[model samples]
Target: MKKILLAVAALALTAGMGMAETVRIGTEGAYPPYNFVNDKGQLDGFEIELGNELCKRAALECTWVKNDWDSIIPNLVSSNYDAIMAGMNISDERKKAIAFSEEYTPPPLSAYAALTPDADIKGAVAAQTSTIQAGYVAETGASLVEFPTGEETIAAVRNGEAEAVFADRDFLAPYVQESNGQLVWVKGQEKVVVGEGIAIGLRKSDTELKAKFDKAIESMKADGSLNKLITKWYGPEALVF
Candidate 1:
């Protein structure tokens, strides 16, 4: 997915524009490090923490909303929440339906994982629904199996339901490292380093909200908190700036 700027004027009716004080941050509570629900049944993750910090820096009253990743954007268009803080990439196609704040996290590669290093991923690949990695798998010779959550995609490979799992490298890194020699990043898969920066998705009409978040992101970058959080969650080698 390549990054593209959004046109807020085209989405005038999509934002909860009048409420300058309260903004509901939407996220998929299934992706860890980026976002997830803790054992306490409360939303917690890097995105949640960063979102709260942004709200705090912007002096805005904010609340969190959990939504399924597949329908996250549609629900946002329906006013389910004020903005989306999910680890969503800012793409040209998505920008048609919503706007985005300047990217807070730089785009990192999406990689493939399998039980063995040389697994034949020719016709069996798994990816989360509606993700760029899913689209990539679909275009490959692989038979694309879809799942609603990131967890399920990885599980598919483990259970022999799919030959390989495609997802963000950072998200899949821990799984590979924890698997001992059981799992590894797929080698010679004819892959391309595909992805764009991750940013907060907003209604195309929410210029005020977009401006607020952009300023917050810029502030965090300037103060080095953005890089700090990246390293904290995705490790030292993760992309910064």
Candidate 2:
């Protein structure tokens, strides 16, 4: 009886261990609408909600970790977290560093915002470092001023550090509206398409984890819940899968 009881307890312990595996999700809690530290001082945003739902669907125990945008990838690669759900766009340059799950968002419009409508975007443009927008600005021959955060990039324009700030139109739209005419889109500048889309970042070796999220995302797309969440956070005009 003692031997049989011991074997049964071992089996139960093994099963519990399997069920308790936790996946750590890393994000930059600074990008609003996408992810942000809300008024409650807790991580809250579109990604926060979507990520939690994805974990539930995948049946994976998950937790959130906040990291700076520039270091988010490095930390993930170093095993500080299991995945990245920050508003990171899927790009070839980034793929060299980490693998990505299926895109959750379509290629978003990139635009320039400046204090004046006539501001010359070609003169100087600010973009967050390590972002595709920064790379775009660099290729355009405009002086590229890189900041570590999206907020600083916008502040660069407000404080005259740069002629304009180039970033995702969705991220910039709220600021422009709240600026009360102090900031406006640079006229005559066409919005450019950037990246493939936003997706979860994972280490290449974590194919199993990536597959789980991809499956969850596909289900959301099929059921239209993903579109509802996108529209809820990004507004009705947001692109949906």
Best by TM-score: 2
lDDT of 1 by residue, 73-138 (tens): 999999999899888887777878999899989876788889887877776899999987888788
lDDT of 2 by residue, 44-88 (tens): 999999999999999999999999999999999999999999999
lDDT of 2: 0.93
lDDT of each: 0.86, 0.93
Residue pair clashes in candidate 2:
none
How does each model score on TM-score? 0.88, 0.95
- TM-score for model 2? 0.95
Q: Judge candidate 2 at residue 100 and give its lDDT.
A: 98
